[model samples]
Target: MTAGETLRGLLELTRPVNVIAASVLTGIGAFVAGGVTSHPVEVVAAVVATGLAVGAGNAINDYFDREIDRINQPQRAIPRGAVSPRGALLFSAALFAGAIGFALVLPRLALAIAGINLLALVAYTELFKGLPGLGNALVAYLVGSTFLFGAAAVGEIGPAAVLFLLAGVATLTREIIKDVEDLEGDREEGLRTLPIAIGERPALWVATALLVAAVLASPLPYVLEEFGAIYLAAVLPANAIMLYAAYESFSDPTAGQSRLKYGMFLAAVAFVLGRAVEVVGAA
Candidate 1:
C-alpha cells in the first residue's frame, strides 16, 4: 500500500480517538489522585502500554467484526480492502504483546491491569459483541478500566477507583444509546444488540435511566466528603448537559447524528468532570 493508505490503515487499526480518550482519562485520573510520579520513564511506558492495549482491542474487534462492518461501516479499512484481516489480526497480536511488555516495566498492578484489559477485550470482541445487554456492559467495563489502570500504576485504588467506576456507568448508558442509534444496521447483520432485541423504546428508556443515575451520582463524591466544591461546580453542569442529551436520545432514537455526536460529547464531559473532581480533591 501507498504511504497515505498505510497511514489510514494504521489509524483505523489504532482507533485513534478511542485511544486518546482512554489515555486522557488515565492521565486525568492519575493527576486527580495525586499520583503523578516523578518517574517520567515509567509514566511514559504505562501510557504507551495503555495505547497499545486499546489499539490491539480495536484491531482485533475490527478483525472479528469484518463482516458486520461490511454492512454498517463499509468504508472501514478491513471492509474496504485497505487492510487485510490477517494483517489486522497480526497487528493486534503485536500490539497486545507490546502492551504487556511495557506494562511489565511498571508496578505489578499495572501489568495485571493490562493483562485483564487485554483478556476483557478479547472476550468483548469475540464473544460478547453479538450478545444482548452484555455487549454494552462489556464495553463500559473496558472504558472504565482506563482509570483503574492509571490508579493501579500509582499504587492506590482510592477515590479514583470510585470515579472510574462512575465513569464506566455513564459510558454504559451511552453504549446503550449507541445501540439504539444503530439498531437497523445491527438487525440487518443479525447482531443482537440491546436495541435490536428489546426494541428501541425500551432500550432507550434503559439508556435514559442510566444517564439519570450518572447525573445523580455525579455530585455524590463532592457531597459526601469524597471531593470539594470545585468538582461539584465543574461536574454538575456537565452532568446537566449529559442528561439533556440522553433525554433527547430518548425522544429521537433515529437521530443518528444527534446520538453519535452528543453521546460522545457526554462521555468526554464525564472524563473531564471526573478529572476535575480529582484535581480539586487533591488541592
Candidate 2:
C-alpha cells in the first residue's frame, strides 16, 4: 500500500467518523455549558481530548475485535492485514495517553472525566461489551456524558443534563438496533448481546420503544423554553427520521440501523442549531 493508503487504513481503524461526531458533541457541550465567553482554551483542549479518546477507544476495540472481524468484517483494517493488532494496541495507548495529558492541563474536572472515560472505554471492550442491555446502556450513558463532561469542564452543569438524558435514550435505541444487526456475528463470537439474550424480535420491540420515547421527548427543550422555534422546527424532522429508522429496523435491521446513526447525528445537529438560534436571538 502507498503511504496515503496506509494512513487511511490507520485512520479507519480509529473510526474517524465517530471521533469527529464526538468532537462535535464536545464543542456543543462547551458552548452550552459556558456560552461563548467561558473557557475557550479549555474547551478547545476538551474537544481535542475527546476526539483522541474516541479514536483510542475505537482503535482498542478494533484490536480486541480483530478476530471477530475476520469472520464478520473481513474488509476492516486489522482483519485485512492493513493494521496489525500490536500496531493498533500501541496507537490506542498513545492516543489515550495524549488525551489524558491534554485534559490534565485544563480543569481538574476535565482531567477526571477524561481519565474515567478512558478506563471505561477499555473496560467496555473487554468486560462489559458482551452483556445485553447493560452494555447498550453503558455506551449510551458514555455518549451522553460527553456533554456533561464538557459542561463540567466549564464549571456549569445546567440544562445539559436534559440533553444527556435525551442523547442517552436515543443512543441506547440505536445501540440496540446495532446489536440486532450484529446478532449473527455476536452469536458466533459467544457474545451475549441484547438481541441474542432476548431474541431479535423482542430486542427490536425494546429498541423501537426507546426510539419512540426519545421522539416524544424531543420537543421538551422548546416546551421548557430552553430553545426556540428554530430548535422545534429542526427537531421535528429529526424525530421523524429517528422514528422511521426505529420501525423500519423491524423489517431490515441492518440497513435501518445504519440509517439510524445518521438520524441520531441529525438530531445532534438540530440540538446544536437550536442552541445557536437561541444565542443569536439573545444577541
Candidate 3:
C-alpha cells in the first residue's frame, strides 16, 4: 500500500475518537478517585498503552469479523481493501506486545489489570464475540478498564470504580441495543448477536431496562454523601438525558440513526457526569 493508504488504514484501526473518549474517562476516574498523583509520566504511559490496546482490539475485531463487516459495515478498512486481514492481524500483535511492555513499567496491580484487560479483548474477538450475552458483558468489562487503569495509575481504587461499574452497565445496554439495530446485517452474515438469537422486542426491553437501572443508579455516590451536591446536580440531569435517549431509542427499533444517536448521547452522559464528579470532588 502507498504511505497515505497505510496511514489511513492505521488511523481507522486506531479509531481515534474512541481512544480519546477512553482517555477522558481515565482522567475523570483519576480525578474522582482522589488519586491524582504527580505521576504524569506514568499517566502518559498508561494512556499510550491503553490507546494501543484499543486500536489493536479494533484491528483484531475487524480481522475476525470481516464477513460480518462486509454486510454490516462495508466501508470498514478491511472490507474496503485499505488493510488486509493478515496485515491487521500483524498490527494487532505488535500493538499488543507494546502494551504489555508499557504495562510492566507501572505498579504490579496496574500491570495485572492491564494484562487482564488485554486478555479480555483477545477473548472477546476470539471466542466471546460468538457467544450470546457474554459478548456484551465482555465489551462492558473492556470499557470499564479505563477506570481501573486510572485508579491503578495512582496505585489506588475508590469511588471511580463505582463510576466505572455504572458506565460499564450503561454501555452494555448500548451494545445490546446496537445488536438489535444490526440484526438484519448480522443475520445476513450468519452472526449470532443477541437480537438475532433472542427476539427483537425482548432484546430491546432488556436494553431499556438496563439503561433505566444504570441512569437511576448513577446518583448513588452523591446520595451516599461521597460526592458533593454539585455532582448530584450536574450528573442527574445528564443521566436523565441518557435515559431519555434510550427511551426514544426503544420506540424506533429499526432506525440505525436512533441507535447511533443513543450511543453518542450515552457517551456524552459519561463525559458530563465524570467531569462533574471530578470537579465536585476536587473542590
Q: Pick the candidate with the highest lDDT.
A: 2
Clashing pairs in 2: none
Off by over 4 Å in 3: 67-75, 79-81, 254-283
Mind sharing the TM-score for model 2?
Answer: 0.85
lDDT of 3 at 191: 80
- Once fitted onto the true fold, the runs of candidate 2 whose alpha carbons sit more than 4 angstroms away are 1-9, 70-84
Best by TM-score: 2
- How close to the true structure is residue 266 of candidate 3, measured as C-alpha lDDT? 55
Model 1 is weakest, by summed lDDT over 10 consecutive residues, at 256-265
Q: Is candidate 2 or candidate 3 better by lDDT?
A: 2
TM-score of each: 0.84, 0.85, 0.83
Q: Candidate 3 vs. truth: CA RMSD?
A: 3.3
Q: In order, what lDDT does every prediction score?
A: 0.74, 0.82, 0.73
Q: Give the per-residue lDDT digits (tens) of candidate 2, residues 146-260.
A: 8877777777766566667778888898899888888887788788988898899899898888777777877877888887788788878877887888888898887787777
In angstroms, give how far residue 117 of model 3 lies from its true place: 1.4
Off by over 4 Å in 1: 2-4, 37-39, 70-74, 224-226, 254-283
lDDT by residue (72-117, candidate 3, tens digit) is 6898888888888899899999989988877777878778888888
Candidate 1 TM-score, C-alpha based: 0.84
Rank by TM-score, descending? 2, 1, 3
Clashing pairs in 1: none
